[model samples]
Target chain A: MMLIDTLAQGLLLGGLYALFAAGLSLVFGIIRLVNLAHGDLIILGAYLILTVTTITGLHPFVAVLLAASLMFGLGWLLQTHLLNRVLGADILPPLLVTFGLSVVIQNGLLSGFTADSRKLAAGAIEAQSVDLAVVTLGVMPLLTFASAVAVIFALNRLFYRTALGRAFRATSDDAVTAELMGIGPQRIFAGATGIALAVATIAALYLGTRANFDPSIGPARLLYAFEAVIIGGLGSLWGTLGGGIVIGMAQALGASVNPERQILSGHVAFVVVLLLRPRGLFPRASD
Target chain B: MTPSRPLGLIAAFAALAVLYALPAIAPRALVQDLFGVLTLLVLALNWNTLAGFAGLVSVGQQAFVGIGAYAMFAAIILMDLNPLVGVLIGGLAAAAFALPMAFFAFRLNGAYFAIGTWVVADIARLGISQWKALGGGTGTSLPKGTAKDMAFVDRIKAALDVSSAAAADALTYWLMLTLAVAMLVAGHVFLRSRMGLGLQAIRDNETAARSVGVDPVRLKALVFLLTAFGTGLCGALAFIQITRVTPDAAFSVIDWTAFVIFITVIGGIGTLPGPIVGAVIFYALQRLLADYGTIYLIVLGCLGIAVMLFARRGLWGVFTGRTGIDLLPLTHRPPKSAAPQPQASRRTA
Candidate 1:
């Protein structure tokens, strides 16, 4: 029963990890550019939500809706105006530029929030729980997991079933060829980033409610997201969820053995997965 | 032949002499400031060697820096070794650690490789933080006895006519100055060597270089280890100056990797003189704007982004492009008279 409960908790925790990584995987898939600032952008979304909730006295979910739309526009403008210029043969420019952006976002938050950790007021939902046949699960974790599944499903449907998804696939396959075929790669990239940021806003909602966050936490979050993305395999959304679960389980199991080993266990799992499957568990067939 | 080579050498030596004599006349604070600058210069050179020449952009260099600091602390606290020797131990430990990390990181390409290094560094930090003997996450300070008994502290105190603390500062500054000069000379010499040519070829195109019998993996691994060694030395020197070792401070990506990358990119990548120019500019900026706190970092990030987007070649690149001067030439250019002779002979033959 104890082991089953631990596994259940781990799988639920993986849901949150998947949320953090979904935006990262989405952006990487569309543009072949890894934004080092992806984690910072998530935190930015969280802060935006916090601000909305504070100003409007609305529910956090409502605040997320507002933050998501705002972030989408911000993402679109960022890609169109800035990221597009740096995208090319050399990978250094995009990576460094994003790193610079990461620094900027982090410090900007620091200046505004003064490095104090903040959490969202989620009311009764924060302490609610659900009972299964063998174990109990927190309502927040269950919601996070459910949301992760919905987000992934929606993203997959959009990619395979929607015209915009077709554009993304075509653009990802070959930007120049897609452009020649009347698909504007620039616009596609902007849309992709916008969508990614919208997903980031959802991740932020859970992040703010589930745990405390500060300006400095973004990079550490980025580490976990990157690990999950890699473990799932690059460019594979489902793989990302699997990767997150693996890490979550590892951390949970490590904590069962020794509390101090929790984080280290997740990192060790990442390295082990990397060593065993360099391309990840479900690397994109195209890649 | 370029007329600048001989003049450059003379100027370099003269600058070294000036730096050597600086502690004698300069205030203690200024010496400490220059020490910080020189430490950063060493780090920039190491980063430049890896990213600029070898095409390996690692944001996890703090892994080595942190390891080096902890290694030094262990030597001082547990092994009861001289701090000077601990510096060397720290460097070797970092290099040894790099071997395994490179095996994992090298399997990754481009941006994945960058993040892979960061993950490794984070893992190291977490692991190191568990060792309660080293004060865990809270960290530890070098014992007062160790500081008082550091190598050459007495000699420096007598020579500088100063107290023990001032003498220690002077000693550290001189050690950093020597290491900085050595790194510059060594970097220049390495880049002019055959391996440097292979590394550059690999950077341009890995598969093409491999076809030409240049082992990209071997060259990259070698450079990675070498840079780790130098970075470890810098980390040890930095911690020695502070006489304290904390996991957070030692493994700080912002201080170690981000600033170094910014300096390298903003000065110029893929050039010998670029890091030096970049380091000077960075030190100047820090001195000027450090009082503003987070604003200074924001300005740095903004400047880094601006430079990457608008001036990719950086300040040194612009300077060399406009003036057509190569003070430290890594590429050999035959004389005008000698250049046509080979082509003419080949045509006639």
Candidate 2:
């Protein structure tokens, strides 16, 4: 019964990881550029939601809609103005630029937020939980998991059933050919980044509501997202969810055994996965 | 790039002389600052070799540094070895660690390699923190009088006729200087060699390079091991001055890797003298704006991004383009009379 409860908790936590990774995977899949600032941008989104909630005294759930739009604009601007110029055959420029952006966002948030851990108050919802037959789960975690699923499902629909998704797939497959067909790859990239950041905003809402967050936590979160993406395979969204669950389960189990090993166990799991299957469990991309 | 002029070589040795003798006449403060600058230069050079020439943009260099520092601490505190030997052991230990690291990270190409290395570094930091003998998470320091008792402190004290502390400072500064100069010269020689040509070829087009008998994996792994040794040596030597060893400080990606990456990018990624120019500018920036909290890093990050977007070649590349003069040119040129056009001999180079 105890082990069952731990697995349930792990599975719930994996939902948040999936949310964290969904935007990252989407952006990487489309642009072929891994934004190192993905985690920091999520942190920035949380800060935006916090500021909006504080200034307007609106519920965080309501504030998040405005924050997500704001993040989408910022992401669009960032891609068009900065990231687009650096994208090229040489991978160093994009990687380094994103890394620099990560540092800048982290420190910029530090100056603004002053390193204090902040959380969003959700009233009674914060204390609410549901008792399943096997275990009791927090309402927030359950909601977060549901959001993750919805976000992934929506992204899947957007990828397959929409003209923008066709543009994205065409551009990702061969930018030159896409451009020959009158689709601007840069515009597609900007759209992808904007959507990714909007998804990140959803992740940020859950992040701020669930636990205390500060500027310095971004890099660790980035590492976790990277691990999730890698473990799930590069282009597989469902595989990313599986990767997140693997990490969350390993972490929960490790914490049950020894508190210090929680994070290490997740990393160890990543290495183990890599050792067994270098291409990840469900590799959708041939590359 | 212009042909290397003998006069530039003469000027370089002259500059090296001034740098070495500065500890004797200049204020101790300046020497210490230069020591710090030189530390960054060494790290930037090693990083350039990986990211610039070999196309291995590893973000987990702090792993080698942290491992080196910890190994040095263990050597001194637990094994009771001399600090100098510990520094050597630190480099060797880091290189040994790199062997396994290469085995793992080499599986990932391009940007994935960068994140792969960062993960390995985090694992190293966590693993090292569990060592109870080395003070674990909180970290430990060198014993009292450890610096004073280091080899040649007595000799440096007698020669310089300075206090033991200053002598110790001079000794460490001299070791770091030697390492820095050695790396610069060795880097030049290595990059100019056939193997260096092969490495660059791999970077430019791995398929073509392999088609032409260049072994990408072997060369990349070798570069990885060598850079790890260099980084580890720098780490061990750096901690000797810091006199402390904590997992947080030793494994600080921001201080060790991020800063080094910025220095490399903002200078010139593939150029030898780029890090030197970048370090000078970085040192100046630090001195000017360090008073403002977090602003210095903000500026660095901004500059790095700006360089990436607008000036991929960086300041050194811009300088070389404008002047047509490379202080240490990597290109080989035949005599002007021997060729109708300069582009003729550029293929092999």
Candidate 3:
């Protein structure tokens, strides 16, 4: 029973982490470019929600939709105007360029909003809990985990079932061949970044509700996302969730032993996995 | 060509000597600021060597810097050595650690290499923070008396007591200026050597480099160690300037890599003086916009995006194309007109 409880809580937290890693994974899979700015973009999305929520006094869920749409546009513009040009054979340019973007976003948020942390007002729903025979779960956390499953399922279906999804997979497989097949690489990348940012918006909603967020916290979030992506293997969505569960369990277990070990434990787990599987747990066969 | 090289070297040395004498003449505060910026310049240049020329974009250089700073603080506070010597030794110890790390990390390709560096940095931080000897999470200060005993501080005190403003400013100025010059010269010489050529070849195409008998793995490891050595040295200099060391301050991955990336990208990657230009511009922008903290980052981001999209070669590439000036001259061969005459080239130019 106790083990079930631990697994349940970990899988839920895994949802939030999967959300964080989803955007990161998609961008990497489609473009082979790591978006260092991903975590900051999530923070940016949260700030957008905070702004709209405060202004309209809407529920956090409603605010999330607005934020997601805005982020989708921002992501599209960012790719079309900036990132698309730097995506190429050489990796350094994109890495350096995105790093600068992360810094800039963090600082921009810092200045726009003071360093003081803010959280979305989730009301009683946030405090509400669902009780199972063996354990109780917070509604927000359960929803977050469910959403992660839904997102992965939806993305997988979209990737394999729909025409647009076929284009995305085709482009990921071979951009030149996709272009030969009448798919525009630029348009596909723009669409992927847009979808990634939308996922980031959902992540921001949970991140804001689950804990306090300030500008400085984005890099830590990025660290978790990177770990998840690496742990699960780079391109697989299901693998990302597994990676997050592994990390989440490690942190929880480490915390059980020593509170200070919480963060350290996750990192140690990542390193241990790397030692055992240098290419990651589920590196893409093509990759 | 040798004669011209000597003249350049002498001029650089003379410039250093003159600057070293400036702290005596300049304001005390200004001298200190210059020293701080110079240390940052050293770090930026070293990062440029690794990420820029070698095509290895490491996001965790803070590992080396943090280790060096901790080692320095530990040596001075516990071992009772000359603080300056302690700092140098700290740098060497970091290099020793880096040598072994490079072997494991260099095995991974581009993105994996970067992620591996970050993991290594996190591991170092975890080890340091958990070890009570290093003050763990809260961090510890250097031995209290060491700051007063530092040679730079003593020199500054003497100048201040004598009211020799120019003399004090000059000494501090000269020290920082000399270190910065040495770092650049070393960077230049390294890039022009056989190892540097091998790194460039690998950067251009790893398969091709191996086809020509270049060991990509070994060359990358060497570059990693050398870059760590320089970065470690920079950390020591930073410790001297700040007079303290803390985990967050010393191991700030963000500060170490972010501004360096901006400088390298904006100035031009894979070129020696790119970081120098980037640092100067970055420092200037920071000073000018100190009060607008968040806006400063936004501007930096927008600038980076702009540079990546339009000025891919960076500000140096732009200026050089427009005006044809070669100031720092990290490029290996001169322009066609500047290259040796056909006869001179055949005669071992």
Candidate 4:
């Protein structure tokens, strides 16, 4: 019964990881560019929410939409103007460019926010809980998990069932061929980055409500998100969720024995997965 | 005709001599700060070797830096070794650890490869936080007695303590400068060798390079180890200068690695002087805008985006490609008469 509770909690925690990894997975899947700034951008979204809430006195839910929309615009412009230029066969340019962006974002936040930690006010919903036959779970955690599932489902549907998704996959497979198909690679890339920022906004919503965050915490978040993406396998949304669960489980179990080991446990699980299955647990057939 | 690449060498030496002589004429604080900046330059150069030339984008270089620092601390505190020797010992310790890590991290490609490096770093942080001898979360300081001994010996038994700080600072600056030059030269030589060519070939196209008999795996692994070694050395050097080491200080991804990435990007990747250019620019920025805090970060982000968009080849590449300035002589040029511009253009198109 205790083990079941641990597993349940771990699975719920995995939902957050999945949320973090989804944006990263999408961006990497489409452009093969690992946005080192992804985690920082999520934190920036959280700050945006905090700003909206403080200014308008709106509910957190409404603030999220505002933040998401703002971030989406930022992402679109960034890709259209900046990142599109560096997308190429050589990986160094993208990595170096993103790495530089990460620094700029972190420092920008520090200067703007004064390095003080902030949290989103979620009211009663934060403490609400649901009890199962064997264990109890937080309502927020459950919602997070459900959101992860919905996101993966929606993304899958979009990728396979929509024209935009086809463009994304086609561009991923062969940018030149997609260009020949009259699909503007630049526009597709901008759309992809915008979508990624939307996902980042979702991750930021949970992240702000879940814990107190300062400007400096983004790199660690990026590390965890990256690990989850790698563990789940690149280019698979459901696989990313699975990878998140593995990490969340490892962290929770490690915390159960020793609180300090929580972060370490997630990292350990990632290494173990890498050693045993270098291609990840569910790598795409084509990849 | 063989190009006049040696002119670049003369210019570099002249620059180095000027930098080395700044301590004689500049303010004391500025001289000390230059020493600090030079240490950062060492790290930037090391990272450029792996990521720039070899095409391995690692986000977790702090792992080796932390390991090297801890090793330096242990060597000085436990074995009672000289601080200078401790830096070398720290580097060796990092290299020893990196060998096994490379075996595992080398298996993944692209994004996976990058994440694999961070995983190793996180694991190292966890282990360090648990170990009691290493001071766990509280962190440990270098023995004051050792520092005092080194200082006193170098002071020639001065009548007062005035010579102590100066001697210690000068020794550290000279040691750091020597090591930085040595590593830069070593890196330059390595990149010019057959192994370096193999690494560059792999970066261009792994499959194509493999088809051409260049062993991609071996080259990647070798570059990874080389990067680890240089990082370890820089970590140890930094540790000695500070006279203390902490898990957070050693492992904090922000202090050194991010700056290097910024430097490499701003300077130019795949060019020898790029990292050096980047270091100078970053140090200048930090000095000028240290008070702006978050605004500085926003500016950095904006600048990064700007650089990526406007100069895809980075500051050095864009400026030099257009102006034909070879400060470090990393590129070769065909004779003006023999330059086949049309053929190159056709191939690219």
Candidate 5:
């Protein structure tokens, strides 16, 4: 029973990891750019929410909505103005640019928010839990897990069922061909980044509500999300969830054995997965 | 071609003389600052070799740095080795660690490869932090007598007529100076060699180079091992100067990798004098903006971005472009009298 409870909790934690990785996977899938500033962007989303809630005195959820739309616009502008300019045959520029962006965001946040850890106030919902027959799960964790599933589902539907999704797929396959087909790859990329940021905002909502966060925490979060993305296979949404769960379980199990081993164990699992399957569990066939 | 031998030799000797005499004329704090600058110069050179020359942009150089530091500590604390020897041991240990890391990391290409190194580095940090003998996550310091008993430390103290701490500082400065000079000389020589030519060829066009008989993997591995060894030595020297070692400090990406990348990029990567120029500018900035904290980092980030986007060739590149001066002369050019030749003919020549 205790083992089940632990596993269940880990699964829920995986949900949050999945949320963190979803946007990363989406951007990488559409455009082969890996945003090294991804973790910082997530933190930026959280801080945006914090600022919104503090000023407007709105509920955290409502603040998240406002923050998400703001982030979407920021993401659109960033991609259109900055990232688009750097995109090309050379992979180094995007990586270096994103790394620089990461630094800028981190230090910017540090200057703005200081180093003090901050968390969103969810009131009674923070304390609420559902008692399953085998285990008790926190309401927040459950919501986070459900949201992750819903996000993946929505992303999947968008990819397969929508014209924008077709544009994304067309652009991913061949940018020149997509352009010739009258699909503006630039605008598509900007839209994709905006959506990715929206997803990142959702991830931020859980991250800020579930735990204390500061500016420096972004890189570590990036590491975890990267691990998940790698383990699940790059560009696969469902696989990302699986990857997150694997890491989450490893951390939970490591914690059960020894508290200090929790984080290390997740990294170990990632390395192990990498060694055994260099291409990850579900590499895109096209790739 | 002009026989540049005498001029080069005289310049080298003059530089050495100035470095050797810096302790006498410069303030103690200035010597310490130079020590930091020299250490960074070594890191930038090694990183430039790997990323700039070999076309392998690794963001996880902290893996080697952390390992080198921890190995030095382990050597001193566990093996009872002299701290001087521990520095060498630290380097060897880092080189050893690089092999397995390369085996895995080399499998991935581009961005995956970059993050692969970071993941391995993160794992290395976590693993090192678990060793209780080394103060676990908190980290450990050098033994009480180790710093005082460092080889040549006593001689330095007596000769310099300074306190033991200051003597230690001077010794560290001299060591770093020697290392930095050695790295520059070695890097210059290597880039001028046949192997270096092959490495550059591979960097330019991997498939074409492979077709022409250059083994890309072998060349990359050699560069990787060499840089790791050098980076390890720098890490050991840096931590020794601090006289304290922590996993976090040892494995700091910002200090070891990010700043080094910025320096290399801003100074003009893939050139001998570029890192030198970059390191100087970086040192100047650090000294000027040390008080600003995050604002300083933000500025650095902005500068790095600007360099990456607008000035990819960096400061040295811009200077070289306008002046047509090749300071280190890594490239060979035929006299103007010679007619233009085909690529094949040029290679044969």
Candidate 6:
């Protein structure tokens, strides 16, 4: 029963990890370039939402709706201006550029908000819990999990069932071919990054509300998101969800034994998964 | 045919002499500042060999530094050995650690490899934090007067007639200078060697290189171990001056990797003199903006991004491309005897 309870809680935590990973998966799926600044961007979104809430005296949830749109614009501009210039055969430029962005964002946040950890207040929902079967779960965690599922479903729909999704896939498969077929690969790439950031904003909502976050923590968060994306494989969205669950379960289990080892265990799980599945659990057939 | 070769040799000797005599003539603060620059230059050189030449862009170099540091601390605290000996042990231990690290990280390709290395570094930090004997997470400081008793700190103190602290600083400063010079010379020689040519070939086209009998994995792994050795040695030397050992301080990604990466990127990625140029500029920028809080890094980050966007080969590359001046050339030059005199402009005749 105790084991079951731990697994249940782990599943909920996995939702948050999945949320963190979804945007990262989206950008890599289309562009095949991993954005190292991803974690910092999510934190930036959280800060944006927090700023809106404090100024407007709005609920954190409502504030995020505004933050998401702004983040989408920010993402669009970032891709159009900065990342687009670095895309090519040599992977060094993209990697280094994103790395520079990560440092810039962290320091920007540090200067603006200081290194203090901040959290969003969500009122009664903070204490709310739901009992399912033999396990009791937090209402917030349930909401986070449901949102993750919805985000994945929506993204899947956008990917396969929408024209933009086709463009993304077309561009992902071959940029030159897609360009010859009358698709603007650069525009498609910008759109993909913009959507990824909007999704990151959603992740930011859960992140800010769930725990305290500061500027320096971005790299570690980036690590977790990256682990999920890798362990899940490159092109599969649902696989990323599974990867997140695996990491979450590992951390929860480690925490059950020794709290200090919680984060380390998640990293260990990543290593083990990679050792077992080098291309990840569900690598894209083409990749 | 070019004057660069002679000029490079002259500049190299002059720089070495100046660096060697700085402690004697220059202020102690200058020695300390140059020490910092030299150490960063060493890190940048090691990173350059990995990312620029081998095409292995690893963000987890801090792992080697941290591992090297913890091993050094353990040697000093547990075995009661000299810090200089501990530094050698640090380098060896780092190389040993790199084998398992390479085994895991080598499985990843390109961007995944970078992430893989970063994850491994995190694991190393966490594992080191679990080491209770070394004070675990909170970490421990060296014994009182340990820096003063280091290999040559006393002898230098007597000769230079300076305080124990200044003597200690001088010892580290001299060691850092020697290490940086060694890396520069060795990097130049290695890049001009057959193995280095093979490594560059592998980077340019792995499949073609494989067809020609170049083993990418073996060569890259060797470079990884070599860089790990250099990084570890630098780390141990750094902590010797710092006199404290903490997991966070030792494994700090920004201090160990990010700034070094920035330095390399700003100077030039593949070339030997790039790190030196970058390190000098970096040290100048740091000194100029020393008053600002976190602004220094923010500026560097922006500059790094700008450099990537506009000048992919960095400042040194641009200089070399425009002026055809390579102070430290990595490319092959044919012997004068092999050149055809038929089309040559013979000024002597």
**TM-score of each predicted structure versus truth:** 0.97, 0.97, 0.92, 0.92, 0.96, 0.97
In model 2, the number of clashes is 0
Q: lDDT per residue, candidate 3, A23-66, as tens digits?
A: 88888888887888898999999999999999999998999999
| Per-residue lDDT of candidate 1, residues A98-191 (tens digit) | 9999999999999998899999889999999988778989999999999999999999999999999999999998999999999999999999
Q: Where in model 6 is the C-alpha error above 4 Å?
A: B335-349
Go through the candidates in order and give each one's C-alpha lDDT.
Answer: 0.89, 0.90, 0.78, 0.80, 0.88, 0.91
lDDT of 4 by residue, B1-349 (tens): 1244477667778988987766445555776898888888888888888787777778778899999999888888878888778888888888888888888887777655676787788688778888788799888888765655664445532532345565566667767788789888898788767778678777777788899899977787777887788889888887777887778889877676766667777777677778787778877788788896555545555666677667756777776666655555543355678975633311100
Model 3 chain A weakest lDDT span, ten residues long: A278-287
| CAPRI-style quality class for the chain A–B interface of candidate 1 | high
Residue lDDT tens for model 3, B65-87:
88888888777777877777877
Worst-scoring 10-residue span by lDDT in model 3 chain B = B340-349
User: Which candidate model has the greater lDDT, 1 or 2?
Assistant: 2
lDDT of 2 at B249: 94
Q: In candidate 4, list every pair of residues with a backbone clash.
A: A104-B301, A107-B297, A108-B297, A108-B298, A110-B294, A111-B293, A111-B294, A111-B295, A112-B294
Question: How close to the true structure is residue B99 of candidate 3, measured as C-alpha lDDT?
Answer: 75
Error of 2 at A163 (Å): 1.7
Tens digits of per-residue lDDT for model 6, B1-349:
4656698789879978988988988899898888888889999999999999999999999998998888898899999998899999998999999999999999888987888899999999999999999999999999898888987788998998899999999999999888998998899888879999999898889999999999999999999999999999999998888889899999999999999999999998887788888998899999899999899999999999999999988998888778777776676655668964532221110
RMSD of 1: 3.0
Candidate 2, residues B1-349, lDDT tens digits: the string is 4345577788889989999998788888888899889998999999999999999999999998998888898899999999999999899999999998999888887888998999999999988888889998899999987878899999989988899988888888999999999999999999989999899989889999999999999999999999999999999998888889999899999989999999998998899999988999999999999789899999999999999988888899887776666776676666789976756223222
Q: Model 5 shows how many backbone clashes?
A: 0
**Residues A103-212 of candidate 6: C-alpha lDDT, one tens digit per residue:** 99999999999999999999999889987878889999999999999999999999999898999999999899999999998899889999999999999999999889
Model 1: per-residue Cα lDDT at residue A159 = 93
Per residue, candidate 5 scores C-alpha lDDT tens digits across A1-287 of: 77888788889999999999999999988998889999999999999999999999998899999999999999999999889988997777788889999999999999999999999898899999998777889999999999999999999999989999999999998999999999999999999999999999999999999999999989888888988998999778899989999888889888888998999899899989988998889887345
Relative to the real complex, the DockQ score for model 3 comes to: 0.63
Better of 2 and 4 by TM-score: 2
**Which runs of model 3 end up more than 4 angstroms from their true locations?**
A1-7, B1-15, B151-175, B327-349
Per-model DockQ: 0.88, 0.87, 0.63, 0.58, 0.80, 0.91
Which scores higher on lDDT, 5 or 6? 6
